[model samples]
Target chain A: MDPLLYDILVALGLGLLGAVLFSAIGLISGTDETTTIAPVTLLVVLLGAPPAGVFTFWMCAAISKHMTHAVPTALLGIPGDTMALPLLQQASALRNLGAPHIALRKMLAGSVISAFIAVPLAVLFAVILAPFGTYITASAPWLFIAASVLIAYFSAGRWASVIALVPFTLLIVALQSFTGAHEVKLGVSYFLGIAIGPLVAELISAASPLERKRMNRSEPRETTLAPDVKGWGGYFPNPFRVLDRSQVRATATAAAITSGTFVFSPVAMTVIAGEIVGARIKHAYHRLTSVLAVRNGVTESTYIAEALIPLIAFGLPLSPVAAGPAAPLFNAPPRFTVNSETGVVNNLHTLMSVSEFLIWGLVSVVIATLIAYPFAMNHARSAAAFVAKRISHEAIIATFVGLILVIGLWEGGVIALLVILTVGLVGGLLYRVLGMNTGVQFMGYYAAVLSVPAILKLLG
Target chain B: MNNPTPAPASGPDGQLAEIWGDVVSRPQLGKAILIGAVVSLAVYAVALATIAPLASTPAIGKALAMLAGIIGCILGGAICARLFQPKRRVVEQIAPGAIWQTEVLDQIAIEGGAIGSVEDLPPAVAQEMREVGLYSVFQDYEQDRARNREAG
Candidate 1:
């Protein structure tokens, strides 16, 4: 068989595998994305999968996970992941309105519409931005600071996020300095710390009487599951038709706009886009549904944009989404390593070209849509019911904990574990109390390495 | 699960302009953000002196930096939490009646056919729709028609 033919088969098969696996995992409500995505992605890299296989698996996983992740957000009144945070307002609001089934349909429809649009648009933008790669990389330190401020300003905390970046950066810089001395260079630790910040905070709070008292509710929280609405004919009804004229328009417009902003935080874009749309719609109910659809669309578009743009154009992790969730594509040790000490680049940027990225990116999206999208539509009710009723938080948390420990041991022994715990607890506390989200923290991590040194040099 | 079908893209995009018009704007997460910023910066500036020495250290500077970071975040989070007041839950305010009204609205919105006005719906539905700022379709019917004509 031709090598190209073999590669195609491998890519397609792996794409489906990734989609199926993550879709089920995503349906497990409250499952954090980084915990689920990072470990498996690292495994693919360490397993020495081919570039096509790795790319296919990763893109498919991200696209599919996000697609199905909306299930719990829309149905169970819980956010599916970090990106799904903005959707919660609408989800909960719509659920309050007794139409979680409608919210789920709208979300799934938006996922299908926006995801299909994001791929080609991301590829196009990446190609356009490719020529500026050199200048962008050269000014990365300054750009990181600017991006830090921009993203921070747009976060839920607004300007407070901007100010919070100072401490977060200082924390990261301090940790990196101390850990670097021990000869235990760490990367995944901080990512894991920020990703699991809330859980770590909750665990710590449980130990304190005052904190535990604050969290205590005498009455158990009740979530009334709305019965699935009966309308709509056929399996996998046309995604476009599921939404109204305004919804389809909002989805398309937001998807297009967000796909171009590869450098901004996905959550920020989702909020801004939804806000922009929300400001225009008069009906509170319609605004909730439309914004939910639009914001969900933004999630898919922003991820696709961030990954494709940086990988194709600069080959450097320029965006938060690129640096965090999509980090494996840029650097995963043995097979792919963007050397921090030497500035040597040997990841997807050095491994593949524009044409290959476009080809494989689209292939991953196509395969993912075929599997995740339809699966989400047809079985959303059953899936949501099962996850809400049965999925154990302990089992999920335990698995993540085990993975974090395993990765910590693999990279730097006990020190790495300490690094992750310290970062996670403090970071989680800051995250919970300060209103600073993980996306902003992820940017702060980048600014520490990329911007802080430059600021110091300028000061000196 | 039933097998999926093709999703044909809809056209006549211009009439949907009314959907984007702002009847509702999202509430900002205000004072918490300001309080968070003030508290964080104060901690960083004060703690920088203690952590500055570690910055000069060779490989270990990174680890020591994190130690200082942890200190700053805790202090900042403490101050911010004290200042930031939590909002009461409004989800509880959504009476069961509102839920039924919303379901009917969703059905109407999906059907995309002409309805005389919010008044044409049941009295409970009309009142709920009124609360959400929804009203008669006829109010903007002429504008949509014009936009649709232009879009076509």
Candidate 2:
């Protein structure tokens, strides 16, 4: 067998695995992308999968998750994940109008179409920006600082998030030195801590006497699962057919435009794009459905561009998506590392050629579309019902607890476990209090690792 | 308006609280976390003791152990799922075309959305609305508003 053929085979296998796994995970509402994708991708990297396999896996996982996430958002009236929040209003309106299946179909179609458009377009944008890679890598320390502040300003907290970065970065710096003294250098533990911060904060607040009244619930949450009507005949519905001509144009155009604005938050991009598209349409029903399509489309395009552009152009985790969910692709350490001093990178960017990234990126998207799109189209109602009825929230929390313990312990032992707890507690509180989200916290981690050293040297 | 107002149910063991976007009994959550920790760590420890020495490299052995530990995490979750039922009251949404459906249009108008005349919609969109049975609803609403404006 040809070595290239072997690599392709491996990439396809991993891509299928990622697609199947994440599609199911996506149905279980509230599963955050970063918290789920980063650790699993890190595991793949550490387990010594080839670079192409890792890249394909991450791409497939993110793409598939976004598509199936619409299931819960449209049918169950719960935002599937953070990205699905912007789609909730339109979805609920459609459900109220007795057409949740239409909402689900529109969102799924938008995602599929956008993902196809985004892959090639994002690759093109990355290539156009690739000329600046050397310059970007050289000034990475300063660039990380600027990116952190910019990302913080754009977060929900705004100025509060910007101000919070100082303490947050310092907290990471302090923890590093503390663990360095014990001769246990930790990276994944910090990532896991920041990624799981919200859950940590919620758990602590649940235990607190002061927060008891707020946290306690006398009755279980009541959710109305809308009846799903399958309008299409086949298992695989054509995206172009599902969307009207104008809807297809809106989705494709939004996907294309957002494929370039990789620097901003994906959620913000989704909201802004929907607002722009929604304001154009006059009819209320058209406005609602069109916004759902465009917003969901923007979610796919923004995530793809944000992750791909930084990886291919600079081999750096520069964008919020890259820094958060796609961090492992750029810097999984030992297997993949971004050198702090010289800014040299040893990751998928350097391992795979530009052509390979484009090829595997498309392959992953195709795989995700083949699996997740049709599955969501055909089995959405049952899948959503299964997840809502059977999967206990306690079980999910337990799984995460196990993940936190295992990963923290695997990385460095007891000292690393303590680091995760400390970081998770502090970061979680800051997130709740200041609205400095996980994305900002991830950028703060990079600032601590990259920027702090350069600043110290300048002072000296 | 067939939706039932959820009645508060007493927990079998302890207090119920909403944590991390879902409701869970406090005692159940605690037990779940314990199961998660004990099962995963126990798997890791056993793998390190048994599998680590047999592998060619220490790192590979450790990586393999971590993989097993992840499997243990899922297993622990499966066990917890079997033991604890989800604390959610799910109601099948009643058929559409209720008064609430019209109110959604009113709500959209209040939110400054344009409930443009159905005449403005593209043929495809208008057809879609008709298929979904919303075309008449929008037309009726528009007529009622027009009458109100004329009377005023």
Candidate that scores best on DockQ: 2
| Segments of candidate 1 deviating more than 4 angstroms | A1-6, A92-98, A157-160, A163-167, A230-234, A278-289, A341-344, A451-460, B1-152
> Lowest-lDDT window of 10 residues in candidate 1 chain A?
A391-400
Which pairs of residues clash in candidate 2, taking residues 3 or more apart in a chain or in different chains? Answer: none
Q: Give per-residue lDDT, candidate 1, residue A139.
A: 77
Please give, as one word, the docking class of candidate 2: medium
**For each of the candidates, what fraction of the native contacts does it recover?**
0.02, 0.85
lDDT of 1 by residue, A5-37 (tens): 887788788888899988988786666666567
lDDT, candidate 2, A79-159, per-residue tens: 999999999999988888888999999999999999999999999999999999999999999999999999999999999
- lDDT for model 1: 0.68
- Per-candidate TM-score, chain A: 0.89, 0.99
Report the CA-based lDDT of candidate 2 relative to the real structure: 0.92
Q: Give the candidate number with the greatest TM-score.
A: 2
lDDT of residue B92 for candidate 2 = 93
